[model samples]
Structures are given as structure tokens and as C-alpha cells.
Target: MSQNGAGVDLETSLGYLLKEASSALRAAMEEVLRPLGMSVTHYSCLELLAQRPGLSNSELARGAFVTRQSMNVLLQALERDGYVTRPAKAPVGKALPTRLTPSGRRSLGAATAAVRSVEVRMLAGMTETEQAGAFRILRSMIRSLNDGDGNA
Candidate 1:
């Protein structure tokens, strides 16, 4: 309960703090990516493709935390810009596997560097041990929430 016993106290809430941190991180990433003509989602898609080529639109959407429709639109733009390509027809199913073109790989290199700088800046104050501990804690939190059984 809050100090007034009414609801959550934003001043002392970990959830609120986490959200603020996420917002700050996103803002920092946007600032860096804007000059490269990329949004976080755009960068995410390219990174996903680089790591796991031949991912379907749905898979890319899930990985990037965007809707399938939004991913499709982004894919269309990427295809038109020669950053990615999809076959004229699905070889196995309705899902057309997408792959990054050479151009996409080149663009991803710059975005990766810019994103890395933001991450490096974000972690400047934390020690290696602290960073590792934070990573474990965050992973545990995600697992607990995903489990949905109050078994953290």
C-alpha cells in the first residue's frame, strides 16, 4: 500500500522505476538511431534477421515485439529499399521466409555500433559484477512474470 494506504506509491515503486528506466533507454536509442534513419523496431528487425535469417513475418514480429501487420508493412518498406527480400511464393507454407540483403547487412553494421554506444553509456556506472547481477535479476523477473503461477 501507499503511504496513504490507497494504492501504489510511485515514489517508491520498483515497477515504476523500471518503466522509467525503459523509457529513458528507449529515448537514448531513438536519439542515436534517428540520425541513421532507423527506429528501434527497424533496428530490431534487422538485427533479428542477421542473427536468424529465413524467419517468417510472424516470427520477426514476435521477436521485435510488433504486430504482424506492422511487421509486414516494415518488411514491405525494407523489400522496396533493397534491405531485405522475400521469395515470390512460399516454399512450404503461407509464411514467406525473409532474409536480409547485402544492403541490410551494411545498414545493420552502423545501427549496431550506434546501439552499442547507447548500451555502453547506460552501463558506465555499473561494475561488471553489478551488471551480471542485474542481468540475472532481470531474467528472473521476466521468467516469473511469464510463468504466471506466482512461483518466482
Candidate 2:
């Protein structure tokens, strides 16, 4: 309990701290991404496409942590803007596999550099070993939460 017996001792609560850290990380990413006319979700989508090559709308939505409808809207804009491409019709089921165009890959390269700077700044104070340990701990926490919710 806190000194005053509050509902939760946020100063020592890992979950509270984790949420705070996530917020800070997001703000920092947004600050960097704003000048490029990209949101975190936008960059995440491009980055996912860069790595995965041909991911479906729903798969990209899940990976980017956005709703399928939202992803579809973004995909439409991306396709119109010449950043991504989809077949005239679905190659297999109802899902159209999405891929990045050359322009999209070029855009992703710039975003990747900007995002990497934020990550480097965030990890500046941590030693390699400490960073590795933190990675393991954070992954464990994610697994625990996801598993508990049957989403893992």
C-alpha cells in the first residue's frame, strides 16, 4: 500500500510504469514521424509490408494493432497515393495480399531511419546486457498478458 493507502501505488507499480513508458515512446515516435506526414500506425504498416512483402489487409491490421476497417481505409489511401499495390482481384480467397511499391519502399526507408533514431535515443542510457535483459522481461510480460487473454 502507498503511504496514504491509495487505490494503487503507481510509483512502484510495474503496469503503471509500463504504460507510462509506452506513452512516452509513442509521443516521441509521433514527434519524429509527424514531419514525414506519417503516424505511428502508418509507419508500422509500411514497415510491416517492407519486411513481410505480401501481407493481407487483416494480417497487416493485426500486426499494426489497428482495426481491419481502419487498415482498409489506410490501404485505399496508400494505393491511391502509389505507396502500395494490390491485385485487381484477390489471388486466392477474399483477401487481397498487399505489397509495397518502389515508392513505398523508399518512403519506408526514410521512416525507418527516423524511427531508429528514436529507438537509439530511448536505449542511450542502457548497457547492452541491460537492454537484452529488458527485452526479455518485456517479451515475458507481453506473453503473460497475451496468454492470459488467450490472444497469444
Which portions of model 1 miss their true places by more than 4 Å? 1-3, 149-152
Tens digit per residue, CA lDDT, model 1, 1-152: 35584668788878899999999999999999999999999999999999999999999999998999999999999999999999999999799999999999999999999999999999999999999999999999888778987555
Model 2, TM vs. native: 0.93
Question: What lDDT does candidate 1 reach at residue 30?
Answer: 98
Q: Which numbered prediction scores highest in TM-score against the true structure?
A: 2
Candidate 1 residue 50 Cα shift, in angstroms, is 0.8
Candidate 2's displacement at residue 116, Å, is 0.3
Give the clashing pairs for model 2: none
- Model 2 scores what on Cα lDDT? 0.94
TM-score of each: 0.92, 0.93
> What is the lDDT, from 0 to 100, of the residue 148 in candidate 1?
81
Among all windows of 10 consecutive residues in model 2, the one with the lowest summed lDDT is: 1-10
Q: What are the per-residue Cα lDDT tens digits for candidate 2 across 20-78?
A: 99999999999999999999999999999999988999999999999999999999999
